[model samples]
Target: MFVKTMRDDKLSLLLTLIFSALCLLTAYRSMSMIAEVLLFIVLGIVYFKKSSIKEELNQREKLFIFAFIGFFVSALTSWIVGSGWELRSVRNPSMPSLIDLDLPSKYLLGALVFLLCVRLKWCLSPKVFGYAIGLGAMVNGCIAIYQHYQLGYSRVYGWSGIAEMAEASALLAVLNLVLFVFASCKKERIFYFVAIFLACLACIFSGTRGSILGFVVTFLFVGVMIFWKKRELLPIFFVGVLAGGLAFVPSLTLEQRQDTMRFDSAENDLKQYMQGNAHTSIGMRFEMWKEAIVMFQMAPFFGLTSAEIEKKMPEILQRSGSALVGIKKANPNNDARGKKHNQILNQAAKKGIVGVIALLLVWFASFRLFTPFLNTSGNSLIFSFCGVSILFYLIFPSLVGEPWESNVTLPLVTLLICAFYKIQKGQKIGY
Candidate 1:
């Protein structure tokens, strides 16, 4: 699939496009599973075909490898401690079963698959990659519109969990705007502009305030990059796109849906909480974070697993006293997700300090990986902009929910990470 022949390059490009198309659209978020199977096949082909393998590990790749290793180890140790050193635990959909490392492992596995793809030169060109992402976001935007207006849904989830959908919408918006900056042709440029509007609409319709936060941060990042690049005239046009994005929410027919974007009531939500009214969304999240703190205190190093966390909840809540009671009231049925509105806090309680460090390392390593492209040109410029800005969508939404740990999100991050590396490689490989 390398550039030995034009035919090989075309097939590689086609395959890459197909792979990119599968992101975030299917049940169980099967992209990672499919990537695992492909990686196994690639490994066997490399072993049997007597092909000489050659690729050096850069600082970015090495850091990513360590981060994922730490993440997997954290998950394993947490499960081990939670199981009481037992080899296996009872099966529960919301809990880890015996040897069940799939959650964290899938993230590492997805990265490996993309690394192999780059090694074989089976990756899209920067222009095509932009289109692939833009097209996917377009489809998701359509789905969001259909679900939000026609179906009378409160928000648009698009076959993913609420957090995943929120993160995706924000990510789609950010990337589309970035793509508009580095677009290769006039048609692509125009389409990317439209993508930005759709993506912003997705953000509004998602009703996840964190997505809006991410979008605003990314929008500013894009503007700064544009201004820094000395493309002074373009920022004026970009501002127009920003206005179109803001118009999406006002067009909504329902006041309640529009209220989702209003942060003015946040203070009121807090004041109500102080009066023992913890039903507001903001109040519930604050209370859940407090509970997570208690859980983390109980098992700071190894952390409790989901099952252990559940078993010890009553004891932890009793100790919490009247300082917090939203968790119990919000989840009388004791739903598995009662105490995890904030992803970082939830990680602290369940995975302990070890898992938390692993999570932070992944973010830090990714920061180092993409920011260097800031001084580049042509297609590689997309990497610098979209890659760094994408982290906002990944991390900000996780502040309010579990986007970072989502099946949909992990694979999407891995695929984009691979694309960034390979696009840089392609620059050297004759793109």
Candidate 2:
């Protein structure tokens, strides 16, 4: 009996480690998800007879699990109807999407791991996690900034395959600044401020329009909250300095400072090249949205299947404008190629009414979870900013970008849900 108990304990520890690693690594392969689920089962069985599950769950814990379940259910519903039509008449059968299956699997496994953490009282403090992520962002942002300057040997290097991934990560670093500035810890505000400033520096240099737009909206929302809360203006001032310092850097050898948004000028010649060589950058997004609308009109019910999306874009582009007729032959943004850029439009095209409704419900549920914190005192200011920042992403990301399946979007959603759950509990039940 002693030996058996020891072995069980070791297995449980191993499972816990595996789950944490999966979360950190963002592994979404089917095999990885299955292995994670099986390990969870093993741990569950080993602990089943030893302790009462009911005793482990509290109201706060229940809220977290329910919120995640709610998110998952919506995603699953969208996927089922969305993918079902395509699966009915398989043609090639060899090139099925690993992502289609892996996305849902990852969400389910992540929810399970998160719930287990809450139940086991292993939840990493948001402050710590936020700080660590913020620090990483600052470093990455600095590197991107260096790269922008075309610094010789001193430039920051990233894997060529994953440079775009840095875009979202850098944005998250900016959000962390917002998170930390609003946090109640009361002592680390200066450190967080510096981190956010560094992130902003990187943003100016990266020349990514998506991150730039996201940051502006996030900042405005955060600005309003800070002002309303009657908080000291010192931190905000520091942020201004950081942004200014990076923007006006005279030492930067790159021509980035000269290009600043004047896409039509000789100094910013890349914009013209983009316009001529790649009709599909931001320009293609506009055409795609119009095409997506026409698609919705054709299939108003369940929308278009994934296969249809894959098949139809070429014809749609031809009808909209031909390459011979002043239109570029190729799109610059690869993510926009298979997607409609707008999530709602994509849903309307992909799953019809069901997909659109499920997505609406998700937004509504997210807002509802965080509403209590919006009106309450104490951390109300910070929570309110965070809520708005998240909403901004939801509304805009779909409008002109397709970051729906990235690692950044999922965690940002989960973070909002977790915060809402915590604030709700702290109010009625007490933390």
Candidate 3:
């Protein structure tokens, strides 16, 4: 019995270590992918070791799960109905067949990870999980700062493969928010302050306008939550402001900051787009959104395939007499021009109104789950802030870009949600 108990404890420790590694390696896509595979295997072993585990999902969790299922069903329907029914790519005939499967498969994998966390709650620690995420963000932040200042790169990317500076900035901003909340709720730690400073520096250097906006919004949200609970905590807020300002000052001198702050350019792009020009960045997004709306109108149920969308774009643009026609004609394989930049519209175009509904339901369920913990103190408050940070990350970036499509953010968010739920339920989680 003693030996069996010792073995079980060792398995639990191994699971915790894997979870930590997952958080630490999030910025590196390849490494994080390997960590996730290991996490699943470890979670499976732990799950099977615990005999006759009871279902522990609350009403909100159940709803979230059901909404995810709804999304899967709708997406699958669209894939089946639209696949092989559209024009084949002359350059790459086998491409469209596998690409459409990306979103659904990602969502399924995320759901699996969430479920495993929920099931094997005993093998997790919320404190360790939070620290792991902060440490990961800190590493990425340091790399980004070095890339921008030392390497003289215009936009810092910090080992986040294929993700743009904006995406990395948004990620660091969200992580910083989580660390701030954790710091406020617990005893002051130098590590938390260092992590937060690095994250802020990275965010500023990355020079992503949308992420900066998201950070401000998240900061306000955290401020309100913290102040509402303890009025005397106002000093901490001031200190954070001072620290963040000092950290961000150096980034303000970067030439990239000017480019990032060009709201006038974005406005001009929109004006150009309205005047039948779609060549600019903001203008191209406007064109894509318009095209997505038209696609949704034509096939309200299970919208057009990528092939159909690409094949039909020329006719559509020519009919509208938009400048996108010339652009599309010059570069027929410009998939970015064809895809929707907004997440909600993108989901609607891909899986129709049903997908939209499912997406909203999932958000609603997450909010429902998070709302209760807001009024609590101690660890619950920490969990609440983490939950709110994830929500902000999900909703804010999805408006301008497909944040969830990344393997890093979604998986990390799901794992954190599981850990937060365990904490909320008063489960004693240890590293």
lDDT of 2 by residue, 95-214 (tens): 544333444454555566545433431222334345554565566566656665566322233332121333444445445656666555555666666666666555545444565556
lDDT tens digits, residues 190-237, model 1? 787777776677667777778777777767767776777747537654
Report the candidate with higher lDDT, 2 versus 3: 3
Candidate 1 local distance difference test against the native:
0.67
* TM-scores of all candidate predictions against the true structure: 0.85, 0.67, 0.86
Residue-wise C-alpha lDDT for candidate 3, range 1-431, written one tens digit per residue: 32344367775567567767766665565554565667677767778877575357767777767765666676777767876335455568754454555556656665666667666545455566677767876787778777876988766666764344445445555555545645744554456666667766666666655666666677667677668775576666656555555666665555554643445567888898788777888877777777677778867888776666667777656554555666677776565224577888987876688777877876787677777877877676677777776676667768777765556655555565666666665532322
- True-structure lDDT of candidate 2: 0.50
Quantify all predictions' global Cα lDDT against the true fold: 0.67, 0.50, 0.65
Task: Write the number of the candidate with greater TM-score, choosing between 2 and 3.
Answer: 3
Candidate 3 regions with alpha-carbon error over 4 angstroms: 1-8, 84-96, 161-169, 181-189, 254-256, 259-277, 319-321, 331-338, 426-431
- How many angstroms is residue 337 displaced in model 2 relative to the true structure, after the best TM-score fit? 7.9
The regions of model 1 sitting more than 4 angstroms off are 1-6, 23-50, 84-100, 229-237, 240-268, 322-339, 429-431
Q: Which ranking of candidates, highest lDDT first?
A: 1, 3, 2
